[model samples]
Target: MIELKSAGELDAMRLAGKVVATALRAVAAGAAVGTSLRELDEIAAGVLADAGARSSFLHYQPGGAPSPFPAVLCTSVNDAVVHGIPNGYRLRDGDLLSIDFGAEVDGWHGDAATSFVVGTADQRDLDLIAVTERALAAGIDAARPGNRLGDIGHAIGGIGRAAGYGLLADHGGHGIGRAMHEPPSVPNEGVAGKGLRLRPGMVLAIEPMLVAGGGDSYRPAEDGWTLCTFDGSRAAHAEHTVAVTSDGPRVLTTE
Candidate 1:
């Protein structure tokens, strides 16, 4: 069932959201050529620990998963789309890195992700990241009380499709609160004024994943956790947790 958070609960959630934003910022600043993905994960873990928070992804076993997630953060590089487990691989110049992280504070959860270029980035790479960020911003702007969930998706899809980027329909956004995932799944592509109606007290994680090539994706190696593009084309993902309020959509996960 979908739970509407009370004002007090929303405040608690903001705390968690702040921690997520801080963690992502730290990871992004540390991400550079010659930096290891594992080191990035460690940086996030330390931030969460110092804040007295817990990792929402650690040991998180989704349905049909063989085992729980092992890492505190997901470090997807280049062609890797999402859920890229941290490894010993060192980043290289011109590599695009996507970092996804979540935090649980006082039992409330917040999830966010950002994509960045490691070193000297190509124009195509920079453009892809900029478009993805713009798409996410559009989606968040569409999220307000009384707006349909489809409005959010449509906003994101419009930008992505117009850019000739493939929209991955498989994985999308979701309602997030006490749990990492909640009711009312938010797809990246949909018709405005359709699906669940947005209302005050509803919080959601709006994410847009765009691929430079066709939107086709596949599981990486035997890890079962990492997802990558089938054609090896670079991908970008951007996300933010927002809350629908009487005034408008308030972004909770901000520095």
Candidate 2:
């Protein structure tokens, strides 16, 4: 069932979102060419500790995952699309990195992800990231009352298609509240005006994962996590936790 958030619950979710935003900022700041992915995860852990928030990723064993997730953040680099486990792999110049983080505060949960280059950036990588972020923005903008859930997906997928990028077909966003994953899966591509009708107090984590190879196929890494593009093409992911309000879409996961 889709459990809509009350006004007070939404306020609590905003607090969780702030913590998630702060951690992402800190992780991004500490991400340098020489830094290891594990080090970046530690930076996010510190942020959650200081904020008195709990990580929504650590030890999380969602269905289909091989084991409990072992880190506080998901660090996908280059071809790796999502669920990239933090490891000893060090960042290098021109490397594209995508970081996903989530936090829980006062029983509310918020999740978000961002992608960027480590040091010097390639034009192709920059373009991929730009398009992915644009797709995320479009998805958020469509998250308003009187609009259907598929409208948001159509908005997101349209941008990727027009840019000649391929969106991951299987993975997308979901409802977020007391749990990180809730009802009403939100796809990255859909027919506009189809699916669930948007309603006030509905909160969703709208994420867009785009691949530069113009294909949607992916493979799991040896670690039982870290999905990588099947065509060896780099990918970008962007996300925000947005709430549908009487006024419009209010993004909770922002700085």
Candidate 3:
């Protein structure tokens, strides 16, 4: 069931959000050419531990194939869309690296992700990331108290469609409060003015994943976690944990 958070609960989520945002910032900064993906995961793990928070993603299993996830940070590069496990692969020029991180504080969860182009980037790659970033902003704007869940999804998905990119349908956003994955699944594509009604104190993690080749299909990696585009096209993902507020959408993931 979708649950409304109290002010106290919102405050706890805010703290967790900060931890995630800070860690993501540090990881992105260190994602230079030649940096190992595993190294970035270690950096994020230390940051979460130092903040006295725990990873919402580490060792997490969500009705998948094998065991729990091994890494705290998701290092999705190039055609890899989401849940890209960190490994010994090193960053390279023109690589579209998407890092997704989640942290828990006092049981509340914060989740966010960002895509970065290592060294240099191609025009198509830059456009993918830019559109995904703008899509996230559109979703946040639509997460108002009176808006329906479809409004948020429509806003996000519309941008990718306008950009001629393919929106991943299977994996979308979700309501996030005490748990990493909660009720009110937030899709990247939907009709506006449809779906559940938004209420104040409802926290959600809105993420938009897009593929450059105008195809939405994806295949699971052999690791049983990472999802990559079927057409071998580059992809980008952007996300933020936000709260529906009376004044407006309160973005909890910030510096």
Q: What is the C-alpha lDDT of each candidate?
A: 0.91, 0.95, 0.93
Best of the two (1, 3) by TM-score: 3
TM-score (C-alpha, index-matched) for candidate 3: 0.98
The per-residue C-alpha lDDT of model 2 at residue 145 equals: 92
Candidate 1 local lDDT, residue 43: 99
Model 2, position 155, has a per-residue lDDT of 98
TM-score of each: 0.98, 0.99, 0.98
Instruction: Please state the error at residue 236 of candidate 1 in Å.
Output: 0.4
* Runs with alpha carbons beyond 4 Å of true place in candidate 3: none
Model 1 CA deviation exceeding 4 Å by range: none
Model 2, span 1-255: residue lDDT tens: 999888899999999999999999999999999999999999999999999999999999988889999999999999999999999999999999999999999889999999999999999999999999999999999999989989999999999999999988699999999999998899999999999999999999999999999999999999998899999999999999999999999999987
Give the TM-score comparing model 1 with the true structure, all chains together. Answer: 0.98
Clashes of each: 0, 0, 0
lDDT of 1 by residue, 1-255 (tens): 889988899899999999999999999999988989999999999999999999999999999777799999999999888998999999999999999999999899999999999989999989999999999999999998888998999999999989988876588999999999998788898899898999999999999999999565655647888888888899999999899998888888987
